[model samples]
Target: MKIRQKSREFIWGIYDFADTIFSMNVVSLYFPLLIVSDLGGKDIYVGLANSISQLLIVLTAPIFGIFSDRTGKRMPLFIISASLCAIGTLAIGFSAELGAILPVVIAFIFANYFYQLSLTFYNSLLPRVGPESRWGKISGLGTALGYVGSIVGMILVMPFNTGKIFGLNTFIPAGGRIATFTPTAILFAIFALPTLIYYLRDERRSKYPVDTVNRHPFKKIWETFSDTRRYPGIRRFIVSRFFFEEGVETAIVFMGVFAEKVMGMPDSAKIVFFVIATTAAVFGSIIWGKITDWLGPHQSLMLVLYGWIIGLIVLAIFPYRWLFYPIGCWIGIMLGGVWTTSRPYLLKIAPAENVGRYFGLYSLSGKAAAITGPLIWGTIILIFSGWNLFAAYRIAVATLAILIAIGTIILMPNKTLFEKHPIV
Candidate 1:
């Protein structure tokens, strides 16, 4: 990572562009709401569908990474993962069966699986992408570009009122449902071309040849588990990430729900909420990346986590929730910084050769505990007044605060100092 290089950076940036389109299409802009409102499913059902996706990642991404490292060819896996996700989006767009939740659920589950796996290869290429001095900056900038794609995709899809595109009324498939997803699907396919070109360009520079192996995939998987504990930094960061991410998932799972049900936000304004938050996160990633270089990872994370805590507090405390526009702004900032910066720190600490395997470990640890945060909030309502909403929301915020505090203490002691300054 110490040597300067942008060939990989420029190439990988193209993939980020593609990935942003996919995340916007599936995660942020269109799909989840389509299932809930147009398809007549419960919000909990949406969570279950995505939870299944993450659960699959918990089970499979590590195996995928082990294979990726053993094989050293990333583009094939990247191509396969992105294609499956795009095809899954196409299927979701065409599905009209309300009672056939099984198909819809399965489509989303597989889409997310591919989406998450792509990252295993993407991250494994980081050392080739740029200098160690610039990893934080490049990673942050790439993430910012990705978020820009999300915002732009949302805006593009916002104007299409018809059931068709390219003179095809593909939005309405069956059962009186408007299953349109033309907006980002085209973007996903088109934007992905550049990434393919880039990865193919660089396949031979790094570990592109497959490794010699006689052991089973399961044996390789066990080897990864045995290897992870030997690195204390990776293990600690994974544990800290799990606890802090509980709060992240809690807020994300319920933000819009709280807006419409508790804060009495206008229904039309919810998408606007998404656009704003994501846009903010885009910039926050850039800003925090610079700061992470300057202040070091531990200090930067502390600041970002505090911002997250305040964002949660404002979400719960303000009587006229609309008055918290500033909070929303900060939430965008903190979201970008928290996620993008946190990652490069792990990349910095991990052993140089095993990035793929450790990243798989990263996905497994964070995602396997994905249910803990949401279930805690769900319990607040179940144990208190099932009919009451806002009070339980406050409890969720309180719980998140505790998580942030505990993580800060554990994180501070293990912070890595640069040889000279924290940044280049």
Candidate 2:
């Protein structure tokens, strides 16, 4: 990477790190457990609640995307949305008392809405800052660093229950649940601050800009949707990724549960598992990103998918907690490439003017799909406590592999395919 590009990637990575903490602490690791284990909500309700939140955003995000497209702005949306989510995270931690499932639920919905909306706009910039050749590397680096944030946030919070820097002693005894509550809130606020601050001051300008927010948000939204109709490759990419992303989301978000509920693992074990995965992701992202420069995004994606699929299969068949390291490492590698590779790849297929609109739809599919994993896996557990985390993981991976295979067959790109019809 050139010095200038490296500089942009660094700032971008910082934003990703700050923002990804929400996914790490609130959505993936801590809050879901807080809801299920502590608040006594069933997985069905948990899943339903999460699903609805995405659905809510799904309804309006494309409109926001269209507005972003019309105005050719990404930073403002990212700052506002991420800030909202950061605040909501604080709201969530404070709502964690035993009797306040309702409050927690409300806060969760709001947090997801803003976090996702922020991502829709954040992703719009993928194609803008970096060279097409280096898109994969750039995106991968940002994503991997984002997961690193997850690792840090979760690690920081573990002291109360787990003891010591390495142990679960993060909590200050007398602070009780409030202690946990305050730290998570403060961290969420602190963690997301960089993203909002940097975005507000960044000097980058969109090549496309317009005066009006969509006069007909829905109709204009449809226009944004219809714009993609001309691109067969983009369609296939969406369908393939709709499945691929879910497995990634499921593992990152629900692994904590799988550790405790199904695998009988401790917090320390969960921390170790995620930390290993997080570390692997950091390196894997760098490697995959570089590969994208050499091989193109699609080839880079295929390579990562192959590694990811193999890992899923291994975990399914082995079903051993000890194997989490190998499997986690496998995931970490491919995991880095997913958002890193896909968004940039999709941008290559989209229209420059519609990056926000299309990316919004792109993110929508993944978030909409996200609700299913928790619901299905959680329900399966309710029925069969004997079912292991590995088995559930296998199912998720297998489903995605099938989707990827079918989509690959339909959308196989031979170099010239994307050049003539860039996504944006």
Q: Clash totals for all models, in order? A: 1, 22
Tens-digit per-residue lDDT, 285-329, candidate 1? 889889877776666777787788777766667635665456667
Error of 1 at 397 (Å): 4.4
TM-scores for every predicted model: 0.85, 0.87
How many angstroms is residue 257 displaced in model 1 relative to the true structure, after the best TM-score fit? Answer: 3.1
lDDT of 2: 0.69
Model 2: per-residue Cα lDDT over 1-424, one tens digit each: 4796787767777767876666766676676677767777765556666777878876878878877777666678777787788777777767765467888888888888888888887777666557676677778778877878877776776665444557434344433332354465567667666655665566353244443554677887666667667875776677676666656666666667666765677666777887888788888888877777666777777767777767766776675778878888888878887776777788777766567778878976777667665566556555544565445555644554554445445446533464533332
- lDDT for predicted candidate 1 compared with the true structure: 0.68
Highest-scoring model, lDDT: 2
**Model 1: residues >4 Å from true position, as ranges?**
1-8, 97-100, 161-180, 205-215, 374-385, 416-424
Which candidate gets the maximum TM-score versus the true structure?
2
